[model samples]
Target: MLDFTFTEEQEMIRESVREFAQKKIAPIALEMEKTRQIPEDIIKGMADLGLIAPTVSPEYGGQGFDAVTAGIIAEELARADVTGSIPVFYLVQASWGHIFDKYGTEEAKREVLPNVTKGKWFLGIATTESDAGSDVAGTRTTIRKEGDHYVVNGEKMYISGVREAYTRGGGHITIAKQNPELGTRGMTLFYLPLQSKGIIPTYVDDLGREGISTGGFTIDNVVIPKHYIIGEENRGFYIVHEGYEYARGLISVICAGAGLQSLERGKKYLKERKAFGQPLAKFEALQFRLAEHYTKLSFLRLGAYWALWTYDQEAKGKATRFEVSKAIAMAKMFASEWSNAAIDEVMQWQGAFGYTRECPDQAAWRAIRSFAWAEGSKEIMRVIVSRELLGKEYISYK
Candidate 1:
């Protein structure tokens, strides 16, 4: 039997987050979109609310909520501004920072996670390099063992929250090759601080998510303390996979929220719009399309929650990797593709007004459009589904 009722507390959480997002995030969303910067005050308020690390244990200075709570927050924040709601900030802390709490050395966790939870040190993953976007196994960053330290060299690209992670937050969990002979096995993860002398950030302007800097940098002989290494040496691949799975699930919720918010915008427009002496709502064609989108979005909502529930079960070590991966990928892939269509439909329903820069619809459109590319591309999600549907040995490649 399947049940999908939110407990009283969960409902309160959802309502509270929705209120905060509507008040704090919605007002500045358009300005942030135009200026390309999320306000520091807003980020601070989010941090104070423990929105940055809701699922992390309180021992680490977090709210210690469960996966469902985190998902609720994701949905509400995304509703306010898909690009500027600071969910990506939360995603980084939850996925990267939480992974460290689980697998990092005691000294590493003690030093980092507290600051991360407090929003003093922004945490992020620097796994995507210039040559290694989706092919994480092909990471070119190298970390050579030295006396009491590891010397690092290589470049990472498209890294989110670059400067802010350093100035406003902690740093990144970097994946570097520790053994050139071991292929993917040679890769090791490090909680490298940006303050490391040889690390440099060269900022590149991005189209959306303006407040957050997306850029690349070269690690020129930077040396990190050996204590910063996460998990076993040359065995961080699984941790990266775990982080990616969590990120995928969150992105699914983000996409779904974008879709729902677009629908809300459409609904408001329909009530205000009239044709042939009747409201746009009277047009059977547009009404029918809106109904279909609403139905699809409802399914996406359930799918997002189910995936989070499955993940919670996994966190307790009750579920298998295959189960977790399959659920998260299913929600992620469907939501990404569906959101594109949902937003497009809303735009068509609004006609010329939807295309205007002043409207929130354009922001929602651009913001959700990236989900089809980020986290994992639509093609990558399909590959995941195919691998699960077919036996691994029989799955097609390319």
Candidate 2:
């Protein structure tokens, strides 16, 4: 018996998030691109609604929502935020906060989770480096134990929330190799405050989602206490994947929501705008495209929710990690491509107006494009699925 219905609580969460996104996030979403910063009011609004890091336990100032519920909030934010800034902001915190809550020390959790869930601090994952994106084994950063502290060295590139965390007071859950001779087995995960004395931050101009900063930082022998370490030493390689999977699931939903919203705008335009002395809606070619895009996006939405549901099942020991990985990879692999194609067509439907900054779909197209490589590249998603289908013995990386 397969059930597709959302629970009563889930529906309420979706409706509430949708209302808030439409009323608050939508109006300022585009403005964020120009400002290059999310408005303080928007962050405050998300905090008030418990939309920031809602997955952490209520004891840590979070709503303790499940994965599906988090996906629902992400979908609404995506639909409303044309620039995709708010969705990025929400999903990163929600995903990494869950990881921190699950594996962080009680001392660290008590100090950090409450501030993050309250939106006073940003929580981010920082496993990617200039030399390594999907290959955790290639990490060059090192962390060595020094009495009561661990000193870190090396640089991380293309990390999200660097500026926010550095400026506003939070940090990334970072990974560093503690015993390079043991490869991935030697890695450790820990919280590294951006405000630490020896840390140096740098910025990058990204193609989209400009409101949230995307940049790198050099960790120059920054010392962190033992309490900041997440999970066990040499176990970061596994724990980091959990955060990535959570983020990938949210991204899948965000793509579906943004694409569907774009199609809705296109539908309205087709009905109102005259083309060849009739509405564009009457054109069979455009109508066919509209139908195809809508149908595909609908399935994408379903797949996204299904993936998130599988994640929940894994938490309850009803599904395996490999099952969750394959499902999530399948959900996210086509998410950016299909959504970008749909938005591109919507832009085509609008002719030249769609290319301008004022057009919402243009912003959406740019925003969704980044997801193809954000949490995990589409290429990596394909690899995960293939590895699952072909078994580890046939893994290409090996």
Candidate 3:
């Protein structure tokens, strides 16, 4: 038997998040672009609603929700936030917070998850560097043990929430090579506090999602205690992918929500705006595009949920990692492309207004563009799908 409907609790969460996002987040979303930071009130509001890191356990001050429930919250946030800032903020914390709760030492969990779930701190994943984006094995960062502590030295670039974590008191679930000869097998994962000594922070002027800073930092021999290590030593390469898969699933849903919201605005505009003395909706060309986009996005939405469901299945020992990876890659591969296309068409429908900052879709277009490379690049997604279909001997990178 198959049930596509959401559970009662899931529906309630969607309604609650939708109401809060529409009433509280939408009005202030555009302002974040100018302010270059999410307002404190908005963070506090998310905290009150348990939207910050709901995947974490209740003992750690989270709602302890699963991946699908997290997607529901992310979808609503995307629907309300035209700029995509809030969705980025919510998804990263939720994804990495789940990782920390599951693998982090009890001491680290007590020290970190509480503040993150409360919105007083930020939790992010930082594996990308100037030299390595999708190639995790190419990471030049090094972490080596020194008696009771570990020392990390390297630089990470194009990371989200660096400034937020640095200023607001949190860190990234960072990966660094413990043995250069062992390659990916030598990697270790740990919580790297942005404010620690030997850490030098920098910033970049991004194209969109101004509310959340996108930049890098140089870690100069930063020392961390053993308790901050996530999972076992040299086992980070496997665990980090779990977090990436989680975030990728959420990104797929966010794209759908943003694309659909733009289509809604387009729908209203087409019905009311007149062209050649007739409503724009009367045009067959435009009507066809609208229907096609809606259909494609509807499939993307279904694929995203299916990927998340597969992840849950894997957790329950009902699915394999290869199965989950292939499913998630398929879902996310077309997410940014199709969503961006839909938003672009909506922008075109609005004439000159869509080109301006006043048009929400313009902001959405810029924000959604980042996801094509975020988490993992769309190219990498295709490679994963192919690798799964083919044997390991056919892997492109190997």
Candidate 4:
């Protein structure tokens, strides 16, 4: 049986983050779309609270939070930021930073992680290419050894944090083919600084999450030193999945939080707005939707936290990697669909006011639409769950 009870310390962390997010992030949440960036003060405040990449070690300027603690922070940030920008910023760092901390060399960790945790630099993952999104094996980027360093050459599209990393003096943990003949085993992962010579950035407009840039970068023979490699060469394929699992776990929680927040807005509208005779809350139809949405979101919140707990258990040797992967995939499979359904229904209840950008739920709905494919596609999540349940021998691609 799953232990759903949170520790007192965890509850305290939740309360602190909830207060900070409601006060600081909620007010400026929509303003980010117009500014085209997160305010510097907001970033600094999150850094001061150790929220940027709290999963990293204290020695590297992070709080060394566990997976569940990180999920709590993600949930609170999602609830506060209807635009969903701040939560993305926090989760990318928390997920990938954990990987870099665990696998990066001492020199690299000392040089990079401190700035990332302090919000002085942005760290993200970049494995997707024009040809590859969820299909990691289709990635065409190439990394080759040259003397004392390595050279990477390829184009990556639909990546997050492109603008931040380029302007903020940081970069992404990128993946490339080090040996083509070995297939997935040939893949290698390394940090590629965005401002390096020969690197070019491209931008695209997203339907939501406007505060953070969603674009791509072309790595044209970008040179990196030996220490930048994450884990061992040729093991990047296996290693990157760990980071993706961490992110998916957080995304499930974020979906639940955003949905519940939208429902709250809907609830307020139902109680205050008059229908044909009385308040909308008195109607069985609208009230039934409200109850159904609340129930699904509540269960989603529970499932998301359960996945995070399973992730933490892997660290303690109480669970296997496959267990963590299955738990995360199952949690995420219906997360975005269910959340978006709830948000869409919430919008429907508000009549014309909900259709415009003036409505916060509109932003929440747009922001959540991406979660179906962000870390991994919803279809891919179903595949992961089925792969584990039916055994690897039954995997279609295999």
Candidate 5:
């Protein structure tokens, strides 16, 4: 038996978020690119609406929404914001905040989650380094306990929200090797505030999603208290995967929403725009593309939601972690490629105008391109699915 419908409560949430996104985020979505920042009003409004880190428990000022509900918010935001900035802003916080709420010590959660949910601080994940993006075992960052505290020394590159957390007042759940001899088991996870001493921030100009910063920080002996440690020592590699899985799930839905919305815009243009003797809609080639894209994107949307539902089921002890991982990987595997291909076809239908900066689909195309490697690379997704199906003995990189 299978049911493919959102709950009444979930439908209400989707409607509410769609309205907010259309009214507030849509109008100013492109403007965020010019400004190079999401407006303070929008951030505050999201906080007021409990849309910022809504996955955190209500005790910490969040709505305590599950993964599927979080994906709904993500989809609506993606539909509205062509720049993809607002969705990243929301998803990062929502995903990482879930991890923090679950594993952060009482002292640290009390000190950080409230400000994050209130939009007063940014919470981000910082696992990628210059030498390591998907290879968690290759992390060069080192964390060694010093008395009652720990000191970190490493530089993270290609990270998001470096400016926001550094300037606004928050930090990232960072990973480092505490015992190199133990391989991946040596890693530890802890909060490293960008505002801490000896931290130097650097910025990079990205191709899209300019509203949110993509940069890195140099951790030169940044000291953190024991309370900042997330979960147990030497188990960060496992805990951080939970956050990555959450983000990959959100990204899948976001790709579907953005691509579907682009199709809607294409539909309008096809109906009114002239091509040859009639409207572009009458062209068999374009019609086939539109139909195929619509159908594929619709299935992508369903697969993404089903992946998220699997994530929620895992929480209820109905599914396993490996199942969730494989499901999320499969959902994210084709998400960006299919979405980008659809957006590209839509842009092609618009001719030269599609390649220009004014074309929202161009921005979307650029933004979605990053997801091929963001949470996890598409190649890595295949590796995960293959690993699950073929077992550990068949793993190539092992």
Candidate 6:
């Protein structure tokens, strides 16, 4: 009763993406993880192939693909290497690029998005502070009006691609308090460039996703042009939320892809690796475990597609925010947790080799582990579902 069908174009696109990722990305993926540097060549190649801005309109030098197509791209990229697909790149394009096209000033779009699509600039979001992750409205960062410009001063920690964007001539769509009295409602989003005076980046070493740098930015009275603001002043919260939803949606596909890849690797290993003159896969215990894991992954994949479809429908006025929110949160939760489980199961099949730092399995394991906490944590996703499904009356203070 269930259908898993792709259009001819979609099928060919998926195959093309898979082939490109494996042939061009896999060879140096391990090295990138070990060094935490995204090669300029890889970025340029993706740009040349028109893979950088899949969702942006062609007017801005993008492909203007639908959400499902974008999801397929994420899946294929993460299947080969999560780091190679590059979360920052996808998140920025899907979140910031589209948001700019929709809400930004014409001048801002002309100045920003074309460079983003050309791979000459890397775009990222700077919302999470050292104290504010899920609670973005509680952030302490402040932006004050100064004639035609705004002075931004605060520190954003655990930010991804700070150094890369700075070195590569891009910037983040930063969120900051626009009106202190308005609290959460009085914030604003700014397309703040890294080259701006007083903007500084400090990189951090992380345990996984070594190919991508995670760090923080310290703005010492950084000045941004007033024209850089996106949407109306003091309504930045909604803009940020919109961006978060898109990011969470695509990241779910990335997690699902990782799970699918892990399952494939495990099956191959079980078939070839033997113990006691028999294939380890011959054991009923292992076979049953893998079966259950695969079932969950299949469910997660379906849920991800359902969420994407719901989001698209909502964007077209065929659905509501509450419906889309629930679907997106549910998909993100299932995909992240189950993908980690699938990865762990695959790693177990490899025994000690999976734990070795040099092995691809180990690199993938660490990279996928980060997904459990990226975008919004699994706990946050649960809270979202609970709030929507149970409403205020069911929220427990007990």
Clashing pairs in model 6, backbone N/Cα/C closer than 3 A? none
Whole-model alpha-carbon lDDT for candidate 5: 0.95
Residue-level error in angstroms, candidate 1, position 281: 0.8
Off by over 4 Å in 3: none
lDDT of each: 0.81, 0.95, 0.95, 0.95, 0.95, 0.81
Off-target runs (Cα >4 Å) in candidate 4 are none
Compared with the true structure, what per-residue lDDT tens digits does model 4 show for residues 1-398? 65668999999999999999999999989998888799999999999989989999999998999999999999999999999999999999999999999999999999999999999999999998889999999999999999999999999999999999999989999999999999999999999989899889999999999999989988888999999999999999999999999999999999999999999989999999997889999999998999999999999999999999999999999999999999999999999999999999999998999998889999999999999999999999999999999998998887
Q: For model 2, name the residue pairs that clash.
A: none
Runs in model 2 with CA error above 4 Å? none
Worst 10 residues of 6 by lDDT: 82-91
Model 5 lDDT-worst window of ten: 25-34
- Candidate 5 or 4, higher lDDT: 5
lDDT of 3: 0.95
User: Which digits, one per residue and each the tens of the lDDT, describe model 3 over residues 37-150?
Assistant: 999999999999899999999999998888899999999999999989999999999999999999999999999999999999999999999999999999999999999999
User: Residue 135 of candidate 4: its Cα lDDT?
Assistant: 97
**Candidates 1 and 5: which is better by lDDT?**
5
lDDT of 2: 0.95
Candidate 2 local Cα displacement, residue 321, angstroms = 0.7
Model 6: residues >4 Å from true position, as ranges?
1-4, 82-88, 392-398
Judge candidate 1 against the unseen true structure and give its global Cα lDDT, from 0 to 1: 0.81
Which residue pairs collide, candidate 1? Answer: 36-210, 36-211, 37-211, 38-211, 121-169, 121-170, 122-169, 122-170
Native RMSD of candidate 5 (Å): 0.6
Candidate 6 local lDDT, residue 33: 68
